[model samples]
Target: MSDQLNTRQARRQAQKKKQNSNNKGKSKKQLIKKIAIATAIAIAVAIIATGITVFAIISNAPELDEEQLMLTQGALMYDQNDEFVSQLESSERRMNVSISDVPSVVQDAFIAVEDIRFRDHFGIDIRRLFGAVAANITDGFGAEGASTITQQLVKNLFLENDKLMSRKIQEQYLAIKLEQQYSKDQILEMYLNQIYLGSGVYGIELASQRYFNKTVEELSLADAALLAGIPRRPSFYDPTVNPEAAESRRNLVLSLMVQHGKITEEEAAEAEAISIEEQLDVTEREAYAYEAFYNLVLNELEEIDGITSSDIYNSGLKVYTTLDTDAQEHVETVLQTSEYIQNYPDNEDFQAAITLLDTETGQIKAVGSGREDSGQQRGFNYATEAKRQIGSTAKPLLDYGPAIEYLQWSTGHMITDEPHSYSDGTEINNFDGTFQGRMSMRRALAASRNVPAVKALQEVGTDRAKEFGEQLGMSIDTMHESYGLGAIPLSTKDLAGAYAAFGNNGTYTQPYSVRKVEFPDGRVLEFEPESQMAMSDYTAYMVTDMLKTAVTDGTGGTANISGLPMAGKTGTTNFDRDTREQYNIPANAAPDIWFAGYTTKYTAAVWTGFNQHSENNYFPSQDSSRQIAQQIFKAVVEEVSSTIETPDFTMPNSVVRVGVERSTGYYQVILRQVVRLFMNYLYVVMSRLEYQKNLSTLNLLAI
Candidate 1:
């Protein structure tokens, strides 16, 4: 009985212990389950938060403009007469073609290389996106791009190119919207049209034309593959720029087509074997005939508010320029024809630039950038771009103009033309290497005497001279006396526009190329240069009179147009002693020569020289080369003046002609006083002699 009782008690104790162990195991399992539930809740919350953020960003994305998906038109340029000149040069060169015109093989070539799943996916390819994300995570950000054709199209049309997350979200959102609106065929067609290909080409059609000189419809499999590869890296895969790299890229595209089962392996092999150069028949787009003027118009367009170079090329903008086609043609003829510019150097490297402007309006009538057409689009525009040392042309604008304006000096004002030096002991010499002792300002200016010009600038003060020059559209940044001799460089455009102040009765208008810009949105931007008074009327007249003497009997004589009332100046810049010694240049050789002149109706500036000056590349001392600028100026003015009725430069009422002694440059009033005093002395002498004779006779009678 006792053992039974003990055994029952032990069993009861064992049961209690087993029950406690079971309760502990249940508590452990319950804690783990709670932890798992919390973790799942956190993940679910995070996913919901991300979804909300993405939806917010997508909702704020830009609305797609269906019209922008169409082909964009290039800007149109017109002349002063409103006649079409040429289409403005743009970075985007596109020729739109319908989807039907593109061959199936060419379409498949793009689809295979650009986006293999283009046909089946929505605008955003989820599989490709996930693969790109995984690749990025494994490597780094931007390791791969998963943008579909639709995404790229939307980015090009409506989105800024950046790597921002918001931009990516918006791009994807727009792509989806675009897919919902257009069919797959339509999207592909738009992509082919909007995609940027190599060599400034924007579409497959233009790419076909640019590379093969053929249409997209006529492209072979290899040709289509070559074009298809360029959009990936346009410059790197440009056939003309990098033929080998382009061929390799093309082969890769062909292989991709085979892998995607769009083309047979045999077809891919055959296409890869063909050399890119063999199929290439590069068609260079012909530049506009008036490319110089067109380039000027384009430059002006860039300055307009809200107008960019892309807008000028793709916005279908209409630009009316100040170009007078007849004058432009005549100017070109004069610069190109040997007969007109008989003094042009025989060397092909010799270049010339000229700018002609209407006197009163400051309109750029014509511009000649080079003596010979370079046949390059937007080549160096010397007329507006090349700034060379103006030489002695600075005399009238920098030195004497300020002198007369500030000092009220007349044309007869005297200046000594002798060996001189600045206060800093810098020697100044005349161009002819000899100096006249003293002469009227008119004679000094007409002869372009360097010493007198420097002296005039000294008397007027460099500060005042610079201020005066600035009023005339010159950017004078130096206070040195050499500036008086045109050590400062200026373009033909600046010279021509500045000289117009004299003919315009002291009014200066900034020269402009484009008259107006008309946008596709019906907004017109007219560019009318504001007129400012650069000098007093009498000051202008005085300078004009002196310049007239320069043209008639001075260094500018070579540029004079017969029977045309004109005022002009000539300028020549020389190499320094060190340069001359280094290059073994002759004493008479110059780097740049200029003739800036204006008739009553027009103003023109001509510059002639080698683009760069070396011992063998300089303008020789020969009459033809040295006087080439003058001769060209004469021809250009003669041609342009034939069409306009040129009148004489009108003298203002405040300007009066005064007589002065040519020898002494003394005023006529002072000479008249001397004559009167001399006559009075003679009369007194005669009266005194008569009195002496009468006294002598009286003395004789007394004796």
Candidate 2:
């Protein structure tokens, strides 16, 4: 009876255990099903939310109006001869070629490099987009861009060049709309024309002409591939300026072309065999040349009545500049080869500037800041901006020109070159400290004597002198005696214009680079330079004649040409210790050198100095500045000699050449004191004796 009871209890327990195990299995299965349903519901919500967001994005995106997609056709600048000089700095510089004008090979080149599925895709490539997203997620940010040609066109035309996610999202929305609105060929044509290639060249047409000197329809396969690679990173892959980088880019394009079956492997190999240098027809970039001349043009344009820099840079207006491309190239070559520029120990720190202007029209022919890679920022051309103390180059504008004009002083007028103390207790000294005692105004100016210049400035009141300089286009800020010695600062352009007045027969026509502008709608605006008769023709001739002595036998003697009648002034501002200390700069920093002069056809200014303080700023000798200026002048004279004739200054009817005794002088009018007058006359006699002695010594040497 006990065993039967035990067996029954055990069986009951086993049954209960089996039932509990079955219930547990059923609950676990039900729980798994509920979890699965919840997960499915969450996934559905995510999909619906994503769909709603995309719908909202597309619905709210901007319309594809024709105006919304209007392209920026930047300004084109032409030289005087109507040949393309360069495309000015602009947001876009495109020459739109129709699909018919664009060759098949050119299209293929862009497609293979930029977007292989460009024709097949509606607008955006899903595979590429997802891959780019994956890459970004993996690598954090900006890991890749999978922009198709359509997307690029949208980004360039409709949006600012931003790389944010918002931009990308908007890019896709507009690209899809663009694909729907325009035909495939239309979209492709727009893409080809609206893209930015290197060196301010936009579109395939301009790019082809710029790189290979060919039209889009005439591009060879290699040329096409090379151009297509530039929009990737214009500056980094500039074919003309950065060839090694360009070659690598070109090869990648060629390889892509072969992989896409657009070109055969053998064909790509042949194209690759041709070196970048051999394939590229362009020898040098005209972009920097354009920047140099355009900076000057931009300044003048700002003064126009209805023009702004924005209008010139963004509008499709055509700018006709007075820039002589050949002359500009020549000047660049001369600067590169000149001794001061070439022999400078520190290549990066030393700076020089050159400005050439047409004397008759006041047209800027050429300009350079320093070397090609002087780290000069755009629009800050040192040629037009570096207003260094102009040194003795100011003597003619400040002292001689005014003295001859207002004071009725002749070149032969006697002057004392001894040190003088002004009423303000300021002492004036000659450059070398040893005075020549007395000299003719012509001799004093030729030698750039500080005392004589100050005396002349005093004779013509400083106020009047400043007025005269202003009329000639100089900015004379101070009326101090030191102003006579070029303590007043001025730019190379200002000095060149001032000197050009002498060559222009005393007419100061404001310097200009843009001669005319043609808007896209066929409206033409002409630029006429504002000019005035700043001085009499007689005075201009007299001053120019006196300046001739400088080139022939004075400080600028090295600047003389064998058969050219050129006149110029050499200005060397010796290092000012006090000024250096005041500025807390190096002792070698204060000195600035200049050569301002003009021929019958052209006037030029050349300046040499350290742009920034450097240990190598020490000039080789006292005459080193003048020697350097002469080298530059000779080079330029030789360059343009064949093109323009060096004519003599026209003698005006009002001027009369006369000889006078060294003692009977125009002295009392300048100095009120009789004793001072006698001393000045005595110095004149002493200078004449010294001049005669030098003349005799030269004659003996010749014998």
Candidate 3:
């Protein structure tokens, strides 16, 4: 009976234990399931937060201009016909792209260079990020770029290019968002368009046009590779200057295309046959007047208000400028001609400038700020800025007009040729001490006589000289000085215009750079020169008469031309404080030689000197300035003379011939001697008659 009871109890106990064990097992399973559910819910919330953050990130990017326009700079040049002559370019080129149409090979090459594993990963590649971070930690700078192509586009197009890691983090995050929202092709297209391809090519189309001068569709594999190669180092690999480097980079692109199987080995080999010329035929660096054009453009850019340089440099703009390509070429040719540059050996050390302007309207016909073959560095530009001393050229503009109009000094008025003391006791004299005791004022000027000029200026007064120059458009500051003997700091440009008063019939025409400027949108800015009458027509004629003599009979004789009315003057400054440089008697060669002259149609001035204001100590001992200056003027006049009709010279309407002495300033016409060979017979006959008459009268008196 105990065994049965024990067995029954054992069976009951076993059942109870089995129920408890199963309950325990069920509780364990429930706990495990709950933990799994909690983890999945947390993961889902995190994903929701990430999606919202990415959505917000993509919305805050740098917006792009709908119309892709490049920034351009240009200048205005008006021709005699008042037509636009030329336009110059001053900016980089940017290209546009099609998101889906981008060639896969080019896209893959970008990936290889910018970001590896681009296809398999999101915009932010953690593996690359970790490696970059580690390297940055050790290297102290983020030398390695962890940015994917999409991240780069985000930074370049939208986000500011900050060096901070925070910005980089934002870039990475935004890139990931961009990857999810836009297709791989779309990102690539944006990147190619945003990337800087140098040589003034911006968008893909322009790049194709600028480099290959063809359409994008026409690009071969090698050509495509070459285009891809420029962005990495545009200046360093510039094909114009460094073709080898550009070629090397191009080959690298070809190898990568071949390695990626985007192009076959055979295609890569054929690329060699295509040659660098086939890829990019011309380089913008080799463009005409590239430096001067850009320089002028940069200067003009300062006029606009509230525009960033980037907007000016990058925005694709169509600029209509005054630069004439043909004129620019000619100006360059004239500047580099043997006549202009060959004279300056070791020209790199010296600098000079020349400018040409129209007389009717003061539009700049041509301008050369420096030598043409001066390599890359344009030396000192004397055209607009260099203040050289104007020697005798300013005399006609100052002394002669005032002497004629105010002092009523006639051309034939006699003046002593001896030395005279000034207020400071400084003695001045004629070219030689042996002065013509008396001579006509016209002859003195024709001879470039110093004493007669001084006497006339003394009569006109120092203030009058200054006033006359001011009338002729010369700054009074330059006009007021004791150096009226020849000292005046002036530029070649101002000198030319001041002398143009003669060409304009004693009316000064101010120099003009922009004859007209028209915007691409048809807005025009035009300028017309106003003629400022500086002297009376009669006084002008008087001065021109003397100046004509200067060219015809004075030191300016070298510049004389018959059959055309020409007037000019020669000037020399003292190489020493005591001697003149232009008309210097101390040195055989004049320091600064100028022949400022005018015909009916043109007023031209030429000045030749060393680049620096070398000390007056070194006498200009070679080349009479008259020779070269007149040669240049003569050549220019001859070249352009036939284009214009000869101008008529109207003589002075009235002449005030005062009763000044012929031999002296006093009223005296002293006759000296007259001899005749047959006078002996007449004298004999008269003596015989006089004697007979006296005898007859004496006999009549005696009777």
Candidate 4:
């Protein structure tokens, strides 16, 4: 009975072990099934999120404007007379050509190198896109791009050049949309017209004309291949700039053509044999007639609040400028042609710049950037850009103007012109190295004496002088006694604007070139310069009177025009001893010479010197070179005044002319002497009465 019971217990124990193992296997299978279901749900959610984000981005893309895809027009500039002057040089110089006119070989060359499977694929090449994506994933984003010709066209037209993912999506979406709307031939034509080739040229037609001086239909296979290679890197592969690089690129394009079966190997070899230089006949575009004034307009456009240089170049805007064409032409002629000026310098290195402004409006009417047109577009503009030291011209503007405005000093206020030194013990000397003592303020300013100007600045205070200069639009960076003798540097534009205040009865109007800009969509941007009272009318008159005397009898005598009611100041800057020794310059040589003058109708500032102050370039002590600025100023004033009716400078009612004795430098010495004699006689009579009264008192005491 014990053996049978033991067998039953063992059987039950084995059955229980088998049941536990089966239950563990079932639990493992159930866990695997639940994980698979959760993974599928997560992937579906990710797909939905990506789809929604892409859809939002595509919806927010810029609306397609078919008209903008057409050939772009350059901005136009009109003069103050509302007359057409010239077309501004835009970023793209494209002349559209029909697809039928484009040679088949030319089209094949572009397609061979740019996009090999252009015709076989949709707007996006899926294989190339995937390869680029894989490359980017491995080497970080923005490492590669798979842009089709259609993609490039849309980006050039509508999108900013940025490496953002969103921008790329918008570009691709717009490209696909464009392909759907237009035929293949139309898209090809547009792409050819839109690509920037080189040398400020756009489109194959213009590129052909610019490089080969021929029509698009006349391009040889080598010529077409060379042009096709330039779009890869315009500046780097430009034939005129880098001929060897351009030739290498052209050969690569030919090889690409042969590889794609667009041309026979023998034909490709023949085309590659021809050097890029031989196939090229470069033709330069003629510079605009009003290039200097146009350059000023471009600079002004850049400073406007919302406008950019791209807008000026790409947008079909109309710029209305304050350029008086007649005055501009005259000024240019005077600067270029020596016959128009008197005592003109004969040195080739000698350069002169002049700026003319309407005194009442502060509008820049004419600007001569140099002695001649540099012919380089947007070259260094000396008139508005170059800054040089202004000499004695500062005396009237910095020293005396502030004195009269703040100190109320009469024109005959006495100031001794003697040898003096600054607070730092720097000795000041007159230009002639001699002092004329006890001179009136008017005479001292007319003579441009160094001592009196320093004295006047000391009396008014340097801080106040700088403040007064700032009010008149003069940039005074340092407060020093030498500023009274015109030690500060200023551009011709700056000087002209400052002097205009004197001519405009103390009102300062900020100088500007552009009047208004009219956009393509009927939006107009008007530029109204800031105007403020720079000084009282009395101060303006006092300074103008002194400067008038300066033109008539002082350093600016040569700049005086015969019939024009003008006031002006002359300035000359010298080299230090060290500079003279280093360059072996003459003792009397001047690095810069200026003649700044103005009429009631206009203000003109002329500067003449070498752009560089080397031994080979400097103004000698001869009258012609030293006084070139005056001659230019005189010529410009004579020519510009003839076109406009200029009235004399009107004296303000608040300013009164007072007579002073020339010898004593005071009001009527004769009257002062007579009053002194009468007072002495009255004192003698009173003394005699006092003595008699004293004698009477003594007699009464004795009684």
lDDT of each: 0.80, 0.74, 0.59, 0.80
Tens digits of per-residue lDDT, candidate 3, 425-458, equal 7777554445776766667777777766777777
Which is better, 3 or 4, measured by TM-score? 4
lDDT of 4 by residue, 562-625 (tens): 8778999999888989999999988877889998999998999989887666786777775567
Which residue pairs in candidate 2 collide? none
TM-score versus the correct structure, for each prediction? 0.64, 0.58, 0.52, 0.64
Span of ten consecutive residues with least summed lDDT in model 2: 682-691
Which sections of candidate 4 miss by over 4 Å?
A: 1-62, 65-70, 89-285, 373-378, 668-703
Q: How does candidate 4 score on lDDT?
A: 0.80
For model 4 the local lDDT of residue 654 reads: 63
- In angstroms, give how far residue 90 of model 4 lies from its true place: 5.2
Question: How displaced is residue 262 in candidate 1, in Å?
Answer: 32
**Residue 35 of model 4, lDDT score:** 87
Error of 1 at 301 (Å): 0.8
CA lDDT, candidate 2, residue 528: 72
lDDT tens readout by residue for model 2, 1-703: 9999999999999999999999999999999999999999999999999888777766765556575345565667888787887665434355778998888988898998888999899899998989999999998656898898898777655553446666677889898878988988998987777676765566788777777778888888889889888877665587755678898998999999998899999999999998986776642434544577875675566566555333454455688988888888787777666543344434465567788888888988888656655543223467886788888998998888888788677677778888686658788777666888867888998888888888888889889998998898776566777777887887788888989999888999877788898865467789877899999787788888888888887888877877777789998776676655555554333357788888889888988776665444545454344366666766776577766667788766566543332345432212224334443332121122223434443221100
Error of 1 at 556 (Å): 0.9
In model 4, which range of ten residues has the least summed lDDT? 680-689
